[model samples]
Target: MLQKIIFIFLLVILVSCGQETQPKPYGELRLEYPKPHYKLFNSNSPFTFEYSDYAEITPAKKKDWYNLSYKKMKANVFITYFPIHNDFNLHLKEAEKMVYEHTIKASAIDTQSFSYPNHNVFGNFYQLQGQTASNIQFFVTDSTKHFVTANLYFNSRPKPDSLAPAIAYIKKDLEHMISTFKWK
Candidate 1:
């Protein structure tokens, strides 16, 4: 009788467990961004660049400082201008220092040099990969009287895999801005 009861219990357990165990498949997100449209950023700040229509340029608290806010993307491109006044190397160091601050969280840092001799716009673009506070930081200077540095910051926490699409989208805009940058 006991053996019969045990057999019945085993059968019930086996029948109840009918589903096979399998690992869940990874998910991929399909995100699309609109084609970029640029507007000339001719300001009284002694510099001009063609910024994306998608962004709204707002002046920062300080003079000659501006924020290119991307409301839809929850990001901002901060532009800081400093008249060299014999401190060109100081400004350059500060910009580079800002980029290195994220080294602890960055998987890698890629540097790209850009030059538009016609416009006297020369700069270094830094792209930070991995979970970092800022993904991109760059500085453009004519190597004399005018120096400008910019940093791209997202409102959300850094998640490289999830943010890759948005990063790529904004990166193109930055490239366009750099290309059209002029010191006036």
Candidate 2:
């Protein structure tokens, strides 16, 4: 009886030891976001644009600065308005400097120039890739009087892969806002 028990225990151990231990494959996380519905943002400020109804717009402490907060995505778009006041170049430099500041962490920065001659709106939209603090930055100005800059920041860690879905969603809203932006 003891010999039979010992033999069975040894057989079980041998079979278990022969089995290969494999690591589970990694899977991507799926995040679903609500379809955005936009509405014209009517503000008493110098300019107006369409914003996603999904986001909550809050007036920043500074004048002409607004925070478009997307709570679900843990992101915020900070929009700042600056009157050119014969300092168009100065404001342009400032905007460029802000975008460049993220270069340390950004893998690449692609800029797209936008022109709306009829509305006198023209500027560069910057898409920053990689683990950067700000994923997107843009500036629109009449090249004379009004200068506006907007930057998108996520409250969480900058993981481009994980944040791709949220980033893409917010990007569409930003593009829409830029397209419909008008000087008030």
Candidate 3:
């Protein structure tokens, strides 16, 4: 009986050893994003634009400022509106300054100019490539009165690789917003 038991135990051990111990085969995480659905943000405010239906807009402390929050994605778009009031140049400078402020941590900054001449909406969109607090910032203006600036920030740490999907997702919304932007 003892011989039989030992033989069985040794057989189990030998069989187990035949299987090579190996680390898991590396695989990239698959992150999926929902297809975008937009809603018109036509409010009593100074401007109107199209925004993602996923986001909920809440008024910031400032009268014309809003924090558009994406609860599931843990991100927010901080939007501030200033009526140019003959200070368009000042607002333009400040918008450029905000983008440059991220230069310390950005690997590269790409600026793309877009205009919807039919809507009278002209804008600059900046994509900050790196682990920065805000990955995207933009401002659209009629170049006469309405000046609106927005920043997109994730609630979590700025891990560019991990956040790339979300960034790309929100960018579509940004594009839609800019194209549909209109000053009231």
Candidate 4:
């Protein structure tokens, strides 16, 4: 009787161990953007990143000027460009106003800034807290070269506790791009 009980326990453990415990893979996201232009700035900042091998970077087309201009992504990453200016602070103020006006349901606020004087680069990172989810806006400028503002929004509420990993990964790449930013 004891031998039979031991045999049954071992059998159950073996069967459970043999069962698959891994999650099924998910399908890739879909996105579309205009042409991409691969122009390099003066800085030596690296743009290395890890994502699915399926993503393609195309040139930013002339037709898509001022609208959302970006390289194709498996995810929806809309990048729009405004003209670069010598007075970057004014541009940042304008961006804040735009966010406040567009995101009517949210209370948008500037969180912090990171500056690199050696590269003449300055950036302000903002957080928009809505009734539901939150959004992020990054306003960057190379005082003598280029001015840029990037806003990232998603349907889900922006919970820092849950969104930290993805945000950190994307921010690293974004910072690389901003650090190397320049004007034609």
| Candidate closest to the true structure, highest TM-score | 3
Q: Write the per-residue lDDT of candidate 2 for residues 66-156, one digit (tens) a residue.
A: 9999998999999999987889889999999999999999999999999888888899999999999999999999887899999999999
Report the candidate with higher lDDT, 1 versus 4.
1
The full ranking of all candidates by TM-score, starting with the best, is: 3, 2, 1, 4
CA lDDT of every candidate = 0.93, 0.92, 0.91, 0.51
**Model 2 residue 64 CA deviation in Å:** 1.2
CA lDDT, candidate 2, residue 58: 92
Each prediction's number of clashing residue pairs:
0, 0, 0, 9
Alpha-carbon shift of residue 71 in model 2 (angstroms): 0.6
Model 2 segments more than 4 A misplaced = 1-24
Q: Which pairs of residues collide in model 3?
A: none
Of candidates 4 and 2, the better by lDDT: 2
Please identify which of the two predictions, 1 or 3, would achieve the higher lDDT against the true structure.
Answer: 1
Off by over 4 Å in 1: 1-26
Name every residue pair that clashes in candidate 2: none
Candidates in order: C-alpha RMSD to true structure: 4.4, 2.5, 1.4, 9.7
Off by over 4 Å in 3: 26-28
Lowest lDDT sum, 10 consecutive residues, model 1, at 25-34
| TM-scores, one per candidate | 0.86, 0.87, 0.94, 0.47
User: Candidates 1 and 4: which is better by TM-score?
Assistant: 1
